[model samples]
Target: MAKLLLVTSLNKSPSLLLLSRTPSAPKLCPRRRCSSRADPEYLCRSIVPTMHYQKSLPRLPVPKLEDSMRRYLNAQKPLLDEEQYKKTELLSRSFEKGIGKELHEELLAQDQRNKHTSYISGPWFDMYLCAREPVVLNFNPYMSFNPDPKPEYNDQLTRATNMIVSAMRFMKTICAGYLEPEVFHLNPAKSDTLAFKRFIRWVPSSLSWYGAYMMNAYPLDMSQYFRLFNSTRLPKPNRDELVTDDKAKHLLVLRNGNFYIFDVLDRDGNIVKAAEIQAHLKYILSDNTPTPEFPIGYLTSEERNTWAVLRQKLLDNGNSEVLKKVDSAVFCLCLDDFPIKDNNHLSHVMLHGSGLNRWYDKSFSIIMANDGTSAINFEHSWGDGVAILRLQNEVYKDSTENPAISPKDMPASVDSSKAVTRLQFQLNNVLKEGITKAKDHFDASVKTLTIDSMEFKLGGKGILKKYKISPDAIAQLSFQVGFLRQYGQTVATYESCSTAAFKHGRTETIRPASVYTKKLSEALVREPSKYSPDELCMMIKECSMYHGKLTKEAAMGQGFDRHLFALRCIAASAGRSLPDFFEDQSYARINHIILSTSTLSSPAIKLGGFAPVVHDGYGVGYQVQDDWIGCNVSAYEVRDVGQFLECVHKSLEDIFTVLEGKPVKG
Candidate 1:
């Protein structure tokens, strides 16, 4: 019965980027603390302090109505037939000249009223908070860290200790305003050097952004960085809210379906000694408690409203103080008792876990399997990948470079038994039933999902560069051809491009399926023999060039999706009837995204992915490296993920062959 409810919820859900470029890591300060503010070390070992340009960052621009509508029509072209296209085009024109103009004005007025944040920030937050589905697959995503270079450091006890210590250092660095500012260096040799930094540091905070811009570098908005610590998303009846308690000093640990809390920060807000943290973690790892019959953590995987009701019951039953502790902890570190067997197993474990050992509501959780493999599964409402990726890179570099715990290190002599307290919940019969039901539903839902990965070593970014093709563009083209070969049709696809270049920016959609890609895919899949290698290569180049344009536009906040969405939101809020454009079938079809994809390529990350947005769609997380292209894909039972991956491999090979001036293999 619980399974049926989960499936029903799944069915009802609106089963609703880029080349792999690693963002530059902030420079770490020297080990010694400087007494004088004028010291070079006190300047973050760079000219500009972290967040130096945040105050001067430009606001995200709302594109013009006609421009957005034009792009929308172009994106809709390849997906619709003659009649359907005509109707949508007419509806779009009517909306643009009439209600859309009014809505745009209203949106501008609202944007003016909210000068502190982006126009889309409020609506975007509401979108995620108002979601009623469980966050497990619907909202939360995971990115796995690469194994440590030192094998011994991968030990669960040692790794968790080092990560926790490094995390504390990162927090301290940010708090002291000494961390290096996040930047995108277009010409690293010129702009990412000490000389450039020394010159830029003298620029006042109000004008620091222009100084960086003048150097052909862009400073990203780091407003979301504050939410990276001491935060959790609280589930309410119809909407959830994010809450943070920076004063909380303890760390939350989940093991064997049990919850434990211990202070990792001192009363003066200093990081506790590493040895003491190791002792506490070692004690937790060595415990032999059996899994709870009704692991309360599973309740976090239930439907949002359901979880809200169950949480209120807990508060009514003398668990309010304990719940507050769980909510206010700096962050969660989940210790899984089982070892992952492979990459697929790692994806499964990290993305959702066994459903018994995860608290899905925390802002972010560092999960360590028994084998010491670790990843971060984060709640999506409070932030995006920019903050999370920066944190992961810094943590990985620090822990690997300056590990505090070694294999021979002994646990501190302190009595961890007295320091760590296992949270005791007085679960009444109703709460117990809720846990059991949640567990059953979560298990059933996950059972229907599939995760598969593929690595193409045949060629990657280096080889594509030789052909003057964009690596990310070629990757998206492969998906188009692969889907065509599998289903004999083109579908709406989404590629995420960050607008972090602007203050309070989120993301804009890059519609990857365009007329150029359609031509390329059809030619490759249907008439490979009709075109010469040169002709096919030309088509490939066209797709790459056009995709690059789309990427730039989306990154600059010129994409049509968000603008249209904001206008629709304005009309809805004003209680005005939606324009004809909103009611068009093409809008619905284009939004039923079938191929939802993103790329985050970094040396510190091994793999990252999320569940498909729709029941029948595929979630593609890929990284295009210098010598290989790796993809981790997920889907529900309705699709053949394995077969789809096979098609993608073949598509890549055929494209590479054409690039090599050879005919497609039969």
Candidate 2:
């Protein structure tokens, strides 16, 4: 369960923080000097530079202590009985008037001292780094790309080659300060146009943010973009540190538990020929090297402290230079030996593979199955989904639209044997035993998890909008109803809301299990015959309205979770006795999170998911499309995931029926 908490703490889903805008097609740079590479025209240019607005972005605000306490008490109500609620309320009131107020002032002073970054950034990083669990299923999550439209482009070698080239283009575009800034345009016609870009470019970098704000456009914090490439999270004794080296010109490739590397960039910072990359990958795929008897990659999946000790041993045995090369590579490319069988199989493969073929420490790994289906499983500590999603969108669009290599194009007539370097590590008996234990432990842990998915086609965002309802709210309501129908009670539910609108922002929690939802769930699940269609419809409208309010507040940094979490951290660091509010059983129960959920919708994403946050909880990665709702659910063997999904499907049907002025049939 502690591992589960770490997963939720870092595994945030894509949120409404970003507007639905398709990335424009890449255009050749006209003003900047071109690279010496053959494909010089691949470089893209933006009207405004990538980090222009970062200096002018507003700092994340800390909510008033009273406001946070009120919100906290409200969120806790649905999960507690009268007696528990009363006692929790008394404890909260006492702390608010006493020690909590003192802690709030301390947090504000700390925030003032750290004006360069968001108040939550350091504490959030500490939360992730301080955890000792293996990150595989605990702190890393996956987002898979939709298959290429042109079936031929889905070939393994071609897709991998094209993606690698597109990724480099993105990296170069950002590093050269030519990539477009990440902005959410409320009215694209007004703010996402050439005129807006022209006007904003003239504004001083220090004042550029005001121009976007005037047009109802928001410029998100792009600080995390730096970690997308040439970054890796290094394990340490009590904490892990993130390392990035932009000078490294190679890409790491893992196949059959073996490591390989080759330079993908030239001295001029231009991408190498795609043909050369294809040829090198082809050679590695055809190599018949037997799987290592003790795969060093498995050590990455071991408990953090154990892996840290083993890593020091590897260094002691003269492996420091090799480890540095692995850490500094631009990114990892995993060529999997197994083909995806179905959507569920794809989810499992991307979430956590056999544990032998993956190096989970890389900032991000582009994994291509034998069948050419691919996904990105990334380390969650350095950044959230916003930066990765942008990369995914760009890579998916560029690789499919402007491929650098085609199937008909033969690999360059260069000897890949001379270009690619296979990395070898000398392992002692202790390290070998550690790797073996890691493999077995990983195998045993993943065996207890079950993943299932379902697609509802009756109605979706479009239909719900006709009734003036929020689609996200309704999706959340369905979960509440589904759980009540299946398990006979309401539990704490979490939906992540991104605060990227602020400088160095991370995420805030949206507590979806509100009193409105509790009432509606009971009405629909236990006594459907007692209420008229209009009555039930009215109840749904209320729930949607309240859920929308929660979403907006969370997005605006007015939510209580982060504020309370920061205050708690401040209190604990004060070297004083902790407040009773922190020790209340209700606090533990609320944070336990039985239904941990997140959602992401994009043309680039076929599906995405994370492991359950608790032993008895469900991790729901959902998307509400125009005419359908899709969910990928994961849980341990303690819960019946299949039955839960069925109940969710039924819940959606019932909600849709009620919206159409019809009674739900039992």
Candidate 3:
């Protein structure tokens, strides 16, 4: 077998890496540019097993592959080590009692179909953006006066409508999610109750509209997978910088209070943008439909009238009014505006798909078109990209037909979910403290910080020109899969299917979600007590696995409360609603899977070049051929079409390593 060698261009700074495959590094730049080849250095050369330790505790035995295989496949050992039972024995097992036939049926059905599947719903976060919407505005508060469906629009509609019903069926086949549409805009007097339910289906399952309405929030569908919005303008910089070049001016309609600024960075290293400054600017909206009664009550006079005006204003002037209303509206930001020049504040809004918790608030990205003719990689929370593109085509196609279907006549419902279970298991070493104390935990930015000078190895030039992550991530990911291939006939490793959540095979654990949950598991897997920590770790793992698996499939199985598992643990632990606990606990499990070398003591892969920031937030890595990627998507994990080139770089570099797997243990 060949050892798959991989490399990346993302870490292009000196001490980090250069863009070369022949081992010759890129031309070194004297001045450090934050986004340039490598400024902050964290390239350590030594290979240490792990950095985990407690003040003065002895090293606990790391489980062997043999032991792990037994625990994963045969279920040989009880999840909880004996010592765990002795320690937290006083905790109630109320969840066990509540978990009845209903719960069992749900899990069983899900397992039968999506046993080897994993799920992920991306959002607009940092790095690559996962675009999705929480809900659709069936009643475009801002209906355009010129609603003409060009031939292309009709064609898209035709293609999308044809696939929808079948797509729903596909969802069932995988037992990933259900297509349930709830109504929030209907009035008993005249609103079509049945009609509205159908309308909601147009929304991508990523939004979990039912969940959103229940909680009173709206998530942004950044995926634009359907290409629903017209790209009036594409950000183009004469140069290849986000700032120096021009991007589309996204006019938003966030109420002054709906958003909280999470980060504001400038090239010159200053947090120049502020919410207060942003407040001076108007948040624009495409549709300004006024909900006579929304958020569980009638809108105040000011709010109602403001929305009416908002919709009207957008239809009349698009974002022109927004620019007028908000003084901080941008014109042309320059590349010099970052690290050394200016700062841009990325106002972090609650991604309706991830719910109100910040932990699940991942970033979003868009795929660029090679020629700016069509969108290639976009997934919205409200609708799928292909579906949206189809819708666009359908509208155009229908325009040319003898008789055309009206946009209002289309089915509004879409399957927007996957077999995502918030597994009921625990990590190997987490404690209650880790779950409850988020502030004290490691911060992503801090974690991303490098330790020392970035290492620009003066190595062979052939190895320096370009880099790829596909092989690197695959090198690690494939090993995991190959192991499962041997023992995972019944269950697939979490990484098996990257496109959808319902895929199944022999998996080490659930995917998409696993990449992130596992990271969370690591944080929680701690030894806080004098008793044997192993016992607690094992118990937590089992419970988490069972519950997580259950959550992902509730949608596919009828009458299955998605929270069936959460409710169970509530009972098993002799407690109340588990959701209440998550909010109270603040332990978010969403995987912000970023692509980079994991924080293992040193990143000296026996045979490798560089790691790219493939997946963001979750910090997991991924490798792919340039032309292949994205099965399921989120608001924060998308890249413009051009980003795919990196995938090509990755594949070319790691082809050999992929065939070889990893170095055989001594």
Best-matching candidate per TM-score: 2
lDDT of 3 at 355: 14
In model 1, the runs with Cα more than 4 Å from the true position are 1-47
- lDDT (CA) for every model shown? 0.80, 0.83, 0.21
Model 2 — which ten-residue stretch has the worst lDDT? 20-29
Please identify which of the two predictions, 1 or 2, would achieve the higher lDDT against the true structure.
2
- Cα-based TM-score, every candidate: 0.93, 0.95, 0.25
lDDT per residue (tens digit) for residues 253-314 in model 2: 99998999999998887798999999999999999998999999889999999999999999
The prediction achieving the highest lDDT against the true structure is: 2
Ranked by lDDT from best down, the candidates are: 2, 1, 3
lDDT of 1 by residue, 1-666 (tens): 000000000000000031110001111111112112332112223346878999888888989989999999999998988999999999999998988898899888888888778987888777778888998888787888999999989989999999998887777777777778877776667988879988988899899999988987788778988898889988899999899988899999999889999998998878888999999998988887777888999988999999999999999999998998899998899998888899999999998989888999998899999888999888887766667776777788778877778978999999999999999898999999999899899999999999999998899989999998988788899999999999988898877666677788776777889999999889988889999999999999999888877877777889898788788787788786777788888998888878878775665788888888878888888778888888889999999999999999999999999999999964
Q: What lDDT tens digits, residue by residue, belong to model 3 across residues 1-666?
A: 000011121221001111100000110101111111111111111111111111111111112222322222222112223553332222222222333333444444444453223211111111111111111110000000112224343232332222222222221211211211111122323322334334434444543444333333211111222122312111111211111111222211122112112112234333222221222221111113232111110111112223233333333544443322221211110000011110001111111101111111111111111111111111112222112222222222222232222334543232112111111212121222222222222222223321111111222123212332222232333222222222221111222111111111000112222332232222222222322334433433443454334222221221111123222432345444442222311112111122222111011111111112222211121322233221111112332212222322332233322223321110
In terms of lDDT, the poorest run of 10 residues in model 1 is 1-10
